[model samples]
Target: MSTRHAVRDDLDSRPWTGPTRRYDILKEGAIALAIVAVLTFGLSALFSSPDEPALTFKGWSQSAPDNMYATMVAEMSGSSETAGYGPPYNVNSDGLSIGPLALQKWFGVTHPIDAAQDFVIAPLQSQQQPDAVTAAVSQWTSASADQRTAWATAYEDALNDPAGANGDATKVPAGDYGPVPTLAAAVVAMASSGAYDGALASAGGHFFNTDNTKQTMLMGDGSYMDDLATAGNLQGNTWGMVNETGSWPGQQWLATYSFWYQLPMFNNEDPNNTVATVLTDNADAIIFAIMFVVILLFVFLPFIPGLRSIPRWIPIQRLVWRQYYREYGKR
Candidate 1:
């Protein structure tokens, strides 16, 4: 018989000579469970997890009112990031196109959002704006699109002046903003009442207001989260998403993918007009695509010609099973 066949037949005929020991599976399992439970509770109690409350518009508006108003103006002018976020949000990402790879646009506005209407006017209407605020909204709705744009632009420009310095609505100088200032001021007042947040949260399906999408989107301008994130090194530039704040080493494991977002092109709001910069603006998509390819390579490692041969060349598995090799003799 061939060596392999002889080895198999002998193994099949081999008698069991190993010693046996009594074992109580239930007892052993119970002990293991008890030990694990104790360790889990001890560790969890020792180091409490991040239990901060969810970020809310009320907190943001109260913390940074000027920033809120400026963001509102940006939304009205369609200059906010959400205004031009392209696909999935229903608007063009301003100019986030890449050599026909407008994948976001291809998906096409699954969740439509008109920033001005959704974030401001609708919320105000839901709160039942006071007569002055209501009149402003009425005038705003009745005006021609150009007139409304002109009004918002004028108001935003006025707010940009020294009086409106530091995003504070209290400082804005007099301007030809028509009813915009009235509407903006009223919205700011509504912020104090937190009606804006309530209106937005309640805007979801009548059955359940669990989805806080609109309320959350209102803070997308980034100013609200910047302070906390920067302090925690959580911003994209700090690679904060992957790293922990302070001296603690955060999830370094995520560095592999997050590395792409740290690149200047991806981090910058406008890194000039180069093609690389354009690609950077759409870094999320690019990174996802890259990760997909990497996953495909790993999944098909055995099928990939050159890559599949790496295991044979390196043979790291031998190191891992070195003791077994010594016991059985090397194949």
Candidate 2:
């Protein structure tokens, strides 16, 4: 060989036969598409989409009228979760915090909710009830705030510990509960008959009150929805946000966002037994603040000092590019 050709030249060192063959690109594309479509159809037929039916007030009221009534009574007395919940709902809201931050209070009241008046009284007043219910409503609306609370408190006690009638508004004793018992029980009956749901749906925003914010809260304040969710292993601590309804895969990507709920501080039990209302409400605000931090971190990851250097430090790039090195690396 000549001295010039004998030199180790990268361009000259590689070998090529210049061989060629006709490839049916269109045919292969069609075959691939058909295979994917068939696999998709078969899988869909074998296992349909996982869709749990929505829990509605109508269903809840019909299933557990007593429980629903009890929940409403608690709400009326300002003892329910919704009543005490912070801004955008009502004042004197509690436990909305993350370290020194009070996000709920800071966010202020955007969508206020008067649990008793909004959930029960408003719905009852929306429809034409019996003469007795009408009388009770009259007294209730005209009564002073203290008088209203007194009546509601008495009814709540009676419902909890019945003297003559059963709790859950089935029947009531001839106690000083007055029109409170009558009104509350009538509300329960209205709910059970599925009238209350429609009333609630139309209560807040006039003819087009399609938003279910208040309705969902009414159920959430009670144990029914939480209990049902718990049964389905959908509690925050259960990693339920990422888990499926059945033993199947779900939105596992949400694990990062839902992880805070599983934390010890956020997962504490309601020692007061008021239930998930207060805790979940507060946890939601706090988790949102933390999630904001997480999102900021993610968005700025590439710009962050040490964080952006992770790929360079780890050097998995070598492994990723190993095949290219073996095929086309310099001698």
Candidate 3:
């Protein structure tokens, strides 16, 4: 063997005989865990927001009845965003796709949702209503699909009109709307009285309901929750995705993920246009794809060509073991 190789092999075989101290690993670990727990509890109690009341459909409807009524109309008409969303809901349109890969469709409609039936019709059917409301529900259910669509369209247009109801179903002008106006009014009343919330909660057919999917979907169909989100600075542009509802620290580590959204390249030029980037309407998918690659790069950093040399170049280990080096050099 060469002199250098012989020396290296000798060094490798050498055992440590330096000054040492007894270490009780278990005791050290227990002490560390106690300190960490105390610090965690202290910091969390000091910084975390108090538990706030959960936002409910009843609270939403009561606070913004006009918006709620408009949302109800949209749900009934099957024109809401959720209604048009395909795959897991219904195949109204192919949902946000990643290039040619229709991941949403491939998964299939695991959680089938019909906006009109689930949000409006079913809830109304389950509720106790007046004679007129009952007649309206019967008329709506018995009508042909085309007739129902026409009635919903006409009523929606009237609601949109500034001179008409303008979101207030009670003030909508008379038209060939069938029993839509009556049904809309009944929904508004039910929502106002908090019965609609109960009806949606029990949609899963359980005495003690836990499924909140229907309730959440119904809320998403409205601008009420959106308004609240905006007010709380929880909008995506505001990095709300990583934020808490009140004055509390959020997922700081997720700041990297949220950074991609702030870029102009990913931002939509027009609010009317759903296509945010060249990825079309799938900005979320594109962002996720980018993040996935970023994560992979991080995971395989040591295997990457130039990246693998970074540790050698920076030599942070020198600083970490400076005391050991000092003691060795003294010898």
**Candidate 3 lDDT, 130-241, residue by residue in tens:** 9999998899889998998899888999988887677666678889988877787778789878888888888856798777776777777788888888998777777877
lDDT of candidate 2 over 213-281, digit per residue (tens): 788788898878998989988888889899888766888999998898987666767666454545564
- Regions more than 4 Å wrong, model 1: 1-38, 92-98, 162-170, 204-207, 243-253, 268-273
The CA-based lDDT of model 3 is what? 0.80
Q: Compared with the true structure, what per-residue lDDT tens digits does model 1 show for residues 48-128?
A: 556557677777778877787788887777777787676677565643444567666676677788887887778788766
lDDT agreement with native, every candidate: 0.74, 0.78, 0.80
Clash pairs, model 2 backbone: 88-109, 88-111, 89-113
Which stretches in model 3 have alpha-carbon errors above 4 Å? Answer: 1-24, 44-49, 162-165, 271-280, 329-331
Is candidate 1 or 3 superior in TM-score? 3
Q: Which 10 successive residues of model 2 have the least lDDT summed?
A: 10-19
Could you tell me which residue pairs clash in candidate 1?
A: 66-167, 163-171, 244-250
Best by lDDT: 3
Candidate 2's C-alpha runs over 4 A off are 1-40, 161-174, 270-282, 313-315
TM-score of each: 0.80, 0.78, 0.86
